[model samples]
Target: MRLAGNLLLAVLVLAALAIAATYWRAGQREAAARAAYPPLGQILDVGGVQVHAHVTGAGPDIVLIHGAGGSLRDFTFDLAARLSDRYRVIAFDRPGHGHTDAADTAGRRFDAPRQQAALLQAAARQLDIARPLVVGHSFGGSVALAWALEQPGDTAGVVLLAGATMPWPGTLNASYRINSSLLGGALVVPAITAWVPLPYARQVLAGIFAPQPMPESYPAEFGLPMALRRGLLRANARQVNGLRPHVVEMSGDYPGLEIPVELLHGDADEIVPLHVHSGPLSALLPDAVLTVLPGVGHMPHHAMPDHVTAAVDRVAERAGLR
Candidate 1:
């Protein structure tokens, strides 16, 4: 019995050591990530949450919101610069995604699209962004929709580029399901933060951009390492895993959004399929123009930037900003 007790104690000690090592590694990685990619935008307080915003250029106001698992850097990289020439471009890190502080560490507080929209709108009000042309990519589209729905009078129009605006029939693949769970948060997320290599991230990015290749410089400039921080990974997982229901609720309000809207998607996009989202959204929106890129993927903005710019121009014209 004494020998068995010793073995059990030995196992417990080994397990404890392993967990400690994991946490130490995770912390080191997080520090390295932050040092590598410090916040490029200013931080503002929005209802107890610290929101990160980057504003540039001058003209009519234009707000840019990036998708899940992305920071505002995604926009600041190229699109924001592209739009900045003509419009005062304002980009923000959505709550829990970038430098912005999540109201709850587990990321439940802003899981609802409306919550994200309300918080971002408050930040915009702080910036004095009046009736801006709001642009969103992927999950950010849902938030843009919410902003228009909740404050129609305040928003001039919306531009959804490969947006995840509608609910889908199937469950998200295993990675999202596992990562969003309690067990995943306690064990898996830290491991991923500590050791998920760059190669794997590249692989995932490849998949996200599928047929269309990810720009070689994208990973470094995008701060992929910083995005893999444990808290952020967990937050992204929770927000995306819990998103479908909010989409279902938000979809019902689509027809009521009477503002000028622009929808653009790649026919080949698999992440937020064209058929499932933009295709159907064009018909639902009271005044929307859908632009389908024949052979592009999820990164439609990157793939066909001119088309995206044209769509913005159309929205501006329709909203009488042009």
Candidate 2:
């Protein structure tokens, strides 16, 4: 009996050490990535939160909101130069992502749509942008839609890229909930950052991208930046189980939207699943125009910029913004 007890004790000790070591590695990876891609200049304070935003171009205002686990740089770093010539494009690190304040204590709201609406109202007021056209990708799409609904008369239009407008199937998994937990957050997240390292995190993200190679800068842009990771994790926690309540609350509001709306979704998208979103959302909205791309994935905007850009042009023309 004594020998058996000793063996069990040893096994427990080993398991605990192994778990600690695993977290340590994750933390290391996160640190390295953060050091590699330091923040670029210019941040804006909207509603007491410091939001990192890049503004360029010279025509009507256009706000680009990136998806879950992304930064403002996701849209602006590579694509801004292209659109700057024709429009005043502004992309911001949404609250709890990128260089923006991780916690929006002032607002005390975690739902994507509410935060998005508040951000747009604050941004427009701060920047003096009048009824700017908005574009949101994936999670950002929900934000764009929410903002338009909240301020219907003030919006020129909106474009959604693989957005989660309608409630999608799938319950929140345990892992997602744990990662978002505040009690576990401080310990688990910091430990993961200190040990596992960015390369490994990049590999994990790669699995989600499917056929396309993960963007060369994904680690630096998403994984390595500890701040971005922290913000993303917090946002995820706040909306655990997929923000279903908010989605439900806002569902009936879609059909009443008065502004021009367009949705672009990939037929092959697995994350948000085209059936749950693009299919139903397109049908519900009073005047939504959806462009379904064959053989494409969730990140179609990033994967196929030219095609997405052309669609944006069409939306602009339809909205009479051109």
lDDT of 2 by residue, 140-229 (tens): 888888888888888888989988778766686675677677766766665655554556766767765665676886655553455435
TM-score, cand. 2 vs. native = 0.85
**Candidate 1: lDDT of 257?**
92
Error of 2 at 75 (Å): 0.9
lDDT, candidates in the order shown: 0.89, 0.73
Q: Each model's TM-score?
A: 0.97, 0.85
lDDT of 1 at 89: 94
